[model samples]
Every structure is written in structure tokens, then in C-alpha cells.
Target: MEDVIVPIVLFSVLPVCIWLVSYFNYRKRLTAHETVRHAIDAGQTVSPELIEKMSLLVDPIRADLRRGVLFIAFGAAFAVLGMMVNFEDGDALMPMLGVASFPVFLGLAYLGLWAFGHGNKSA
Candidate 1:
């Protein structure tokens, strides 16, 4: 009963929290952009420097590498913790391994993306 309740709460809460945070952040940025646009429309002096910073380019390689490393770390932690846990009748190690496989596989996929000429994209 406890196990089912915990995962259910976590799955629901985590996503909703993330969604709310992202939604608010998006709204905040949108508002800031709107303010700058309004200022410009009213013949107010807006900072071109701020606009330049807002239009910054993202480097995909750095992002992918960061994600790959983070995912791999999470996967390793899950696997290690899974191993250290004692389950009833030793019947659930497989389940733990299954859980661990998700991030490990995802991390490997991201690393593969990094390897596939992402470094050359900016050149």
C-alpha cells in the first residue's frame, strides 16, 4: 500500500511541479518581452544590449553533454541503490535493474548524439 501510494504521489506531483515552474517562467519571460516591445512602441529608449542578450544562441553540444552526464549519474545511482536494498525474498532485484536501465539507456543515447558530429555543427 505504501509503495503504490508513494510512486503515485511522486509521479503526479513531480510533473505538476515541473509544469507549474516552467509555465510561470515562460510567462515571466513573455512579460518581460512584452514590456520591452511596449517601451519601443511608445518611442521609449530600450536597451539594444538586452535584446542582444535575449536572442543568444544555444550550443547544443554543451547541453547534450550535460544531460548525458546527469542521466548517466542518475542511472548509476539508481542501480547502485537498487543493489544495496534488500527486498522480500530477493524477487525484486530484476525490477530494480529494470528501473536502472531507463536512465542508463537514455544517457547512452544522449552521449551517442554528442558523438555524432555535434562538435562540428558550430564550425
Candidate 2:
């Protein structure tokens, strides 16, 4: 009963929180754009720095690297946990490795893309 309730509440609440966050972020961006537009329409001079900051994008390489590191860490943790469980209970080793390998592979792929595409080879 506790297990069922926990998962149900967790899954439900997580999605609702995520949706609220996403909605708020979108609203914030829209508000910013409206403010900038309104300022310009009102004959106000926008600073170059503000324009630059607003136009800046999240660095893809950095994002990929972050995800890769996080995935690798999670994979390693799961793999280690799987190994410990296997040693203790003599079951779930393959399942654990299987779960771990998914993230490990995904992380490796992200890192590979970052190295080959985003990072400078000559540097």
C-alpha cells in the first residue's frame, strides 16, 4: 500500500511540478520579450549589453558535457549497486547492468559528440 501510494503520488506530483515550471519559464520569456518590445515602441533606447545578454544561447557543448557527466555518474552508481545486490542476493545482476548500460551508453554518446563536433580538435 505504501509502495503503491508513494509511486502514484511521486509520478503525479512530479509531472505537475514540471509542467508548472515549464509554464512559468515560458511566461517569463514572453514577458521579457513584451517588455523589450514595449520599451522600444515607447522610444526608449535599449542597451547593447541587455540585447546581448538576452540573445545569448545556452552553450550546447557545456550542456552535453553536463548531461554526459551526470549520466555516467548515475550509470556507475547503478552498476555498483547492481554488483552489490548480485553479491548479496544472487539475482538482478543482469537487470541492473542492463539498466546501468543504458545511461552509460547515452553518456558516452553525448561525450563523443561533444569531442568530435563541439570541441576543437587542434586545440
- Model 1: per-residue lDDT, tens digit, 43-111? 998777876555432345655777798889988988777777735436656777788899999899888
Total clashes in model 2, counting residue pairs 3 or more apart in sequence or in different chains:
0
CA deviation > 4 Å runs, candidate 2? 6-57, 119-123
Tens digit of lDDT per residue, candidate 2, span 1-123? 998999999789969977996797678678778878999999999999887566443345655788798889989999999999998889779999998999899899988877776756332
TM-scores vs. true structure, each candidate: 0.59, 0.58
